[model samples]
Structures are given as structure tokens and as C-alpha cells.
Target: FLRAIGKARLITPLRSEGGHRRYSRYQLRIAARARELVDQGTPIEAACRIVVLEDQLEEAQRINAEYRRAAEQADPPPAD
Candidate 1:
């Protein structure tokens, strides 16, 4: 599974001094999602793309939430 995703360029784990590839928590999380997709009969390539898009969407949502909070603070709602 690791080799599959690495070949697809999804998650690239770092090489250790002993020449062993080491995966971080972040990378593991992505790999887990890909594995789930693969288990459900999705192709590896498509699964990787889905994982990447999901991450992008999550980041966008986080940024939008911050902007919303800022806007609300800048202009409070009028008294009811």
C-alpha cells in the first residue's frame, strides 16, 4: 500500500539514516483514507485524487470560517 501511493505521488515518506522510509502522522492519515477508498473498490489513482481534494476542501473551509469570524467581529449584528 505504501509503495502504491508513493508511486502515485500521493504520500512521500522521508528516508531514515538507515535507508528506511518513515511515514509521519500526516502521511499515515492520508494513506489511511486511500486504503479506505481502495477497500471500497475505488482505483488507487482515483482514491489519491479524492484524498487530495478532500484536504483542499477542508483547508478552504477553515479559511472561510476564519474570514467569517473576522467579518462578524468587524460588523456586529444590529440590536434585535
Candidate 2:
């Protein structure tokens, strides 16, 4: 998966006392986003740019709004 997104070099294996590789939450999120974008027809470089470089604060806000609306509609409160 790392190689597929051209991040084989960036992804490093973490060593624990037991010698197990550990990945941080942020790294996992980045990998997941990369896979998603790649599957959506975005080139690896462009996917990385959009997910990592481009400012996504506004896009995040819009997504949050949509999620909140969906949650509200999913189980609306009962009438008094």
C-alpha cells in the first residue's frame, strides 16, 4: 500500500521494546486518505498534495457540517 502511493520511503517502521512496528494515528489517517484518493482516480502526487499540502480547513468545516446534519436527521428527537 505504501508503495502504491509512492510513500514507501516516508513510511518508517517503529521499533518497540518487543520489536513490533507501531504506527501513529496521524500516519494511519494519511495512509487511508491516500488510498481513498488514489482509488478515486487521483494521481499519487496530486493525492498527496491535496491531502497533505493544500489547505483543507474549509473543506473540513464543510464536511463537519454535513456530518452534523446527517447525525441530526438520522435520529431526530421525539416531540414533547
Candidate 3:
């Protein structure tokens, strides 16, 4: 499974001393999600790309929210 995904350049797990592939929690989640998408009739390549884009969009939204909070903190409202 990992080998196929690795070949597709989706989730690149690290290799241990014994040359065994080791995946992190993040990778596991991604793999599970890709599987879900594939099971939904999505193509393997498209599924991987969709998962990656979704993750990126979520991260970008999170960063934007943080920046908004920081900006609000840096500038206080007028006296009430």
C-alpha cells in the first residue's frame, strides 16, 4: 500500500535502519483519507491530490484565522 502510494509520490514514509518503511500519525491519517476517497469512486491520483489540497486549504485557513486574531490584538477598538 505504502509502496504504491510512494510510487505515486503521495505519502513518502521514512525508511528505518532495516530499510523498513515507517509512517507517522499524519501519514496514517492521510492514507486513511485517501482510501476513503478512493472507495467513493475517486481515482487514485485524483484522491491523493484531493487530500493534499484539502489539507493545504485547512492549514491556510487556520493561519489566516491566527493572523486575524493577531491583528485584532495589535489594534484595539475605540473607547466605549
- The candidate that achieves the highest TM-score relative to the unseen native structure: 1
Global lDDT of each candidate: 0.98, 0.73, 0.89
lDDT, ranked from best to worst: 1, 3, 2
Better of 1 and 2 by lDDT: 1
Leading candidate by lDDT: 1
Q: Write model 2 residue lDDT over 1-80, tens digit each, in one string.
A: 76554454434656799987677786677778877988999877777777665337767888999999999999898999
Off-target runs (Cα >4 Å) in candidate 3 are: none
- Each candidate's clash count: 0, 0, 0
lDDT measured at residue 29 in model 2 versus the true structure, 0 to 100: 78
Looking at model 2, residue 20 earns an lDDT score of 77
Instruction: Give candidate 1's whole-model lDDT.
Output: 0.98
TM-scores for all candidates: the values are: 0.94, 0.48, 0.92
Among residues 3 or more apart in sequence or in different chains, the pairs in candidate 2 whose N, CA or C atoms overlap within 3 Å are none
lDDT value, candidate 2, whole model: 0.73
lDDT of 2 at 78: 92
Would you give me the overall lDDT of model 3? Answer: 0.89
